[model samples]
Target: MHVFEGLEQRIQFMVLEVAKQVDETLRVLISPDEANIEKVTSRDDYIDNFKSVIENACFSRLHGQSHLDKAGIDFIRAVNIISNNLERISDFSVDIARQVQYLSDQRFLDQFEYRPFFRQILGALDIVVRALFHRDLSLALRICRAEFILDKLYKHNFDKIITRLQTGKEAQNLITTLFIFRYLERMGDSLLNIGEAVIFSVVGEKLKINQYQALRDSLDSLGVDLPLREVDFESIWGTRSGCRIGKVSGDNKGDSTGVIFKEGKHKKIFQEKINIHEWETILPGLTPKVFGFQESRGNASILLEFLTGCTFQEIVFNEDKEFFEDAFFLVQETAAMIWQKTLKAQPVPCSFIAQLSKRIEDVFVTHPEFNTPQVQFCNLMIPSTSELLEQLQQVELEVTAPFTVFIHGDYNSNNILYNQKEQRIHYIDVHRSTHGDYVQDVSVFLVSNFRLPIFDRIVRCKLNQVSLHYLHFARQFAQEYHDTTFEIRLALGLIRSFITSTRFELNEEFAGSMFIRGVYLMELVLAHQGRPWEAFRLPDRILRYRYY
Candidate 1:
């Protein structure tokens, strides 16, 4: 048998041994005894020895061979990462034991709520062990998710300690326990890193385990072993915040799966699931089939059917001028069709005004600098973002929809894909699809065309024309259906687009233009706040809304 034959089993055994030590340390953590501390401390030596053995074995194997395949290297990396994490976890257990030795009274440990933290870490360690050996991406995701659970548990317990301190609890006892929790939480983090490395060894996705699990769940229903293309780190947009989008090239030409990873307060993942449900269950083939999703730990991910074609954004910016009108019309027509889509569910009041209100509220809170009177849109005087929202509240919005229809909550051009050859319009990012006002769809359609970040003066003029034309088209459609509030509604939609889009616009000048355009729409709405909905006029067109 080769040395590499039992390598995984050896690594697994080493990890299990450290886990045993962690359990012993945790046992002593609840009760302070000099002998128990010595035992836990001694376990760290064995843990360190195993770590060194694994490290040396990995290096020796690598140095002994001139050309190792990607799988061999990745396996070595995974083993090393797991060893390092297990060693750190053992070290943390010893640290916990040391902190326990500092305790003047063992009663404080009993007073604390640490069972959950211990349970989570141990559970995570077990999951990692299984996932590492079996290469179960799903179990890896659970291990990754467990770290998040433990971190939150740590924070909750930390707050309890601080609150106890503020109330005059003994600092020494509480501080010692706090250090133990901190060490355990750090161990959880190390375990999560290990899970990532393990998944990378198997999948080569280079993302965390939760992300890998999302992909696994997404593909489970597809029933294909389609080769996953390399994800370019540079191509993954918005790495820090909001929705992170990535593409893996598909087997068929022009077909590539799109990935959306979002983190933080907002939960768009659930909404996207509903959207795909509508597409697959209610309106098949109009939108891409969603494979699956995972929403946890304040993060959400969506795996979407690869819709191949130029996005309307790409078409508007890169395609020739002759295709512009067709692109705009097709996208608008698709939005109209989505609006005309019917289902039996009870429809809610139109959320156009409600969405704008929420987005503007978020704008003021996140980008307070946009709340000044210094902003302008083509000589249009604009005040604070909050003031604009107030004016919107004062306006009498017609909540009763002219016709309740399924609308893409975010009907931006970026989300619209057109395949001219197939004469099909494909929609992406449908997290906001809902039964709402068609006017909302039209409104989003208009501003999405206007907010292209290109700096070319000619392109700006052309974009403005497309937006204005689409507005008229929407108005004409609304008039045909006896919905007379298209003008006012579009203004409200522009405000949502201009303000909310700033979250994505990185260019200083371009973001400023979006803000100004949004403010100008606010000014337009306020100018005609009390007027009849039919009497509202469109704002002056943008000539130079571009990035430098």
Candidate 2:
């Protein structure tokens, strides 16, 4: 082996050593025998020294004037991240050891009678350690992937401890158990960090591959199979808010995933029949292949077959223009299909004015002082704002448009998917689909594309004339997709409404909102296009959303 090869081997050895130490510490934590805990605590310096040596070696390589190959650089980066994660895991192990020692000193360790919780933490640690050393993303995924189970385990144990503390007369030991359980949960968290590091090392990206389809592509190329075992709402990755992302197995023929049990508010309120009916009827072909839906703990989660494709945003921005025409046409076609399906499924007309009115009311109630004469009429009274709002009011959306199909509530470029080999298009991120105005989908789609500014910022494309291109393409899309009328008016109306709703609260800060800036940009373009000056001014406080 060459010198870099030798260094790579050495780094791998160090990672495995740290993983071994982690395993040892976890074992001591589970049993908490005085001799074993003391031994693990005593080895803290050795872990620290190991880390110091690796850091010096990395620095030495950087200083030695030895040029590193792509693989070497990638390896060095991976090792560095892995080394840092291991160091943190070791620190956490030491913390667990100290907590265990304290519990033993007070004779509190014996009073707490739950060993299964420790076992769960130990399992999580073991999985994480193997994941890092072997770079087994499947194992790493199982570690991140098992967060929900361990989360429930912690919660169950926590409840037991809490119940004991509340009802029992002498419960100081329960408090210690709570702390110990907390350490165990923290151990799981450290394990999650290791999993994330492994994923970053493997995929070269972070949490971008959450949707099933994206994950499938990422793993398929690696020839790895990470099956979704079960949906655990309490799993570390199974939180209700934010992104609900998890992993599943790729191999389906061998071992099927276990049934996940969820008992939560979502199950009580959500109608499975309705969800199933909606999937079957409204989105016949749109729903992802449902593996199953279950209520775990107090959260409802569903597992579906992983998708294998790329996002429209990724395709448009990343791929070369030699493929641009085909990619753009695919996006246009996909959006058209989704738009048509949306129209047929849900033909109900929602009053945007009523919605805006309620939102305005909520804002006033939240900030009662905004009702003051100076504030209420202040920005609206401004010529620019009043003039802009007046132009917007001239355009009235009749909930009466003939097309009444299901509309993707947030139809943006991000939701469109592309398959290269099949030369096919798929629409995803369909959770927010609903029945609404055709223009609502159309206008929102057009406006969303304006957000990236990728053409303007990175590629040095002239955007002043980009509107012409946008208008031209949109018209072409309308004809190609469904032969709709050619007009930027609906898109402009959506932009105007978006500006009004967002800027009302931001009135004091007019130069903040991008919508406001976009309106300003519209004005500059309209000025160039020989449109009225009144068309360009933004509604009151609407400029606030555009900080710049």
Candidate 3:
């Protein structure tokens, strides 16, 4: 607390100094006084020096011997961002003052409405300390709104300058005036950053103004009376969906039933909302209940009931054998129920190759070494990455699912949750859910279990066992439904899942294993091409991690 207090005081001092710089710059702009111009320019050095002091203090508190809590670290981070932006504002003020010299006539600037720019900037700056220190969402929102006002003022003046330029008179003065307004506009940009940083400090998560508003609207829709400041937000990281997902709960931990808040592009979030509703219709309790949904200009947010359970990933790594078996059995039962209930008698071409093509570049971006070139081994031509893809594409053309089933598109282990007490299974991140070949989910589920970075022999053995068990179960389902190409189609799906998954993996050895397995599967599928598709068998060795 002492360290934070010290840093806050330093920031407050910096804010006051920067405010003085802006006020002095405004005076110089209104009535060009050589003394005032010098004051604004000279004081910039002091502001820079103060910024360095505050920055060093922040870093010291963060990396020093003293251990600080999460809130403390977030506060320090916000302070650092705020101080840096404040310094930028001061530099912009000095730049604006310098531009005043370019005005041939001081009244030349009088034609444009510049006074409101200063008024907005100064008003926003006035509340930076209070908004940040007091953790006031209202004040922070006010600060962010100032940027819009400044932008509008800048646009008006810009239009006027362009009109005056068309007259082909005083072009230089007009351009110079535009530079001053541009610098003013930049100050607004910095203020927006400062306001968001303050919000980050309060929420302890980096949320844009739009996202904050979306969250507010979503909570309001649910008739939740809690203030934004009272909501605790914990971000769920490691999500590749590009959505801002977090768990939101009220300050009263005992009484609060938390909800998952997700905000992203309007299309993605809206699609997810629709998918959730569809899933609810297919299986009543399979997906989280949507508490609220709101769409803005181009983004949307949804509030989902936070399902209480441990993910399948947790069950494998943490739970005992009995618990793991119960969870796995529930997963199998749930998969069977969903597939059987939604089975449609329609032939669907396997899209694994197409899916792989879309994401292959991303894979090479992460693991370029996996992109093999054609090579000759004992008069045998080994296909390159592209050639392998070509061969697989041709092979995939011959294999199609006999029937389609509604499936969880992204069937990763972590996406499946098992509520132990209730003995129930639930799925999350179901935006990709749709009526598709059930092999797609099977392959993803297998690779998801296999590619988990857990390297312990016992844990890996469990993962392998689970993967094999599910593979056999799926195979039996295929046989019962007279689906002949399930094995071949699943191989293609595995190849796609295995290779594309490497993009998210950084561990070279582990990623290399997955890449090799994918290539091996592709080769096997190609080797058995032109033969009865049902004869193409997926060797269990390909899925097992051999401890070498």
Candidate 4:
């Protein structure tokens, strides 16, 4: 074989070896009767060794050749990608093995049906193997097609198992089922990832979710059930924490078990939590689906399905104007909903203040100087408290002037979820909701905006603030929520709180504090309104949001 061809062969051989190990690991994980967990654990060493050998071999080839042929370079890159995928597979397999060992001592096998679980793993593995070994376009297509099927299957199985356990008669059995469900679903995902890699190699096109769906549909028409649907919440016997436990009704227990469809399928829609169940109801938009809640579980956790939307921080910083518009609108809508439906006058938690104080202490006490040439945390940028407090007190006067609404604690851009397709904005992670001075959310959101550039540029020009970007976004946000004086107060209060909390490290050389930023912004707002700082010239960027 030629150099490039020889490298392809080597990668193909490695893929086959990894695939074999994966297959064994899946079987060992599913086979409750056998104690093969240790056997699978021991096999990971071989996979790791194979990966290291391939890395070295690839490196050697690059070093030995003065100028590699284009085809040879392409082949090497492909081999590297394949090697990385194989290593990930190995890591996942080891995790599965460990999970299986944990489940071994429990009643995992008794509640969860391992047959379908094993099949999902096997199907995922088959797709990856075909992509690597044969380079068959059809096989690559099949692998790409399996991701959604697997996702739906996992959801179905998880819901079904949870429902079965809810009847609560077999607490031990339920615990076992939980572990099995979590592991099987996780392993299935690893296999799906492998399939995605295979498809990427063959088509040189990254499959969007919609593309995968089309492929899945095509395969389904040919009688291949690529992705499957699951059963309802009531179908499985389950128990609530305080509710009395009961046996699965002979009538309800025989609900159709979730299946990996081969082509013929039926659509069964389960009622999402919005249809029933009452908790902290965020008006439906671009939010994660709350699966259910455990009232007596102490901490009120809404079982939220995973979300894929990127944070506003990512969008704004990337300078994607299209995404930024969507993010801006989404935040606006979410704020509106909170004001209209959720915001209520309530007592603030003592714990929140304590935590905030601790955060300030940790940020400033040890690093008492701003001059240190080290980046502290990747996230926060704090300023010295004493320097920023006077301006903040002026803003707080506006906040405490009788309008306090609910605060979305930690109201940074990261907490909002935007759906581009649905054109929706949803509030998420509401576990920290507090009825504090509305300024808490406004301050966090505004100051946090300083962390993003597009907004910061505007603030820097307008306010010459530390987080100039944030001040700009906050000002616009404040204008948008014009219906409530509470919002303006909240915004002002937020700045004040930010000022009080601002503290730099012990060194002056490190960076300017947020207190400085707050002072700049406070002055800008006053200047813009023709109040005290009216003579101050608004910077060009801040003019983007100039009052009409």
Best by TM-score: 3
- Candidate 1, 288-358: lDDT as tens digits: 76665776665555566656677776677655766766766777776666555562234344445566666
- Model 1: runs farther than 4 Å from truth? 1-274, 280-284, 290-305, 318-325, 338-353, 356-368, 373-383, 396-400, 540-548
Question: How large an RMSD does model 3 have?
Answer: 15.9
* Global Cα RMSD, each model: 11.8, 17.9, 15.9, 22.0
TM-score of each: 0.52, 0.40, 0.60, 0.36
For model 2, how does the per-residue alpha-carbon lDDT over 436-472 read when each residue is reduced to its tens digit?
5655655555444443323334432322223234445
Q: Is candidate 2 or candidate 4 better by TM-score?
A: 2
Which candidate do you rate higher for lDDT, 2 or 4?
2
Between prediction 1 and prediction 2, the one with superior TM-score is 1
What does the lDDT read for residue 264 in candidate 1?
25
- Ranked by TM-score from best down, the candidates are 3, 1, 2, 4
Winner on lDDT between 1 and 3 is: 3
Per-residue error for 304 in candidate 1, Å, reads 5.3
Clashes of each: 0, 33, 0, 42
lDDT of 2: 0.49
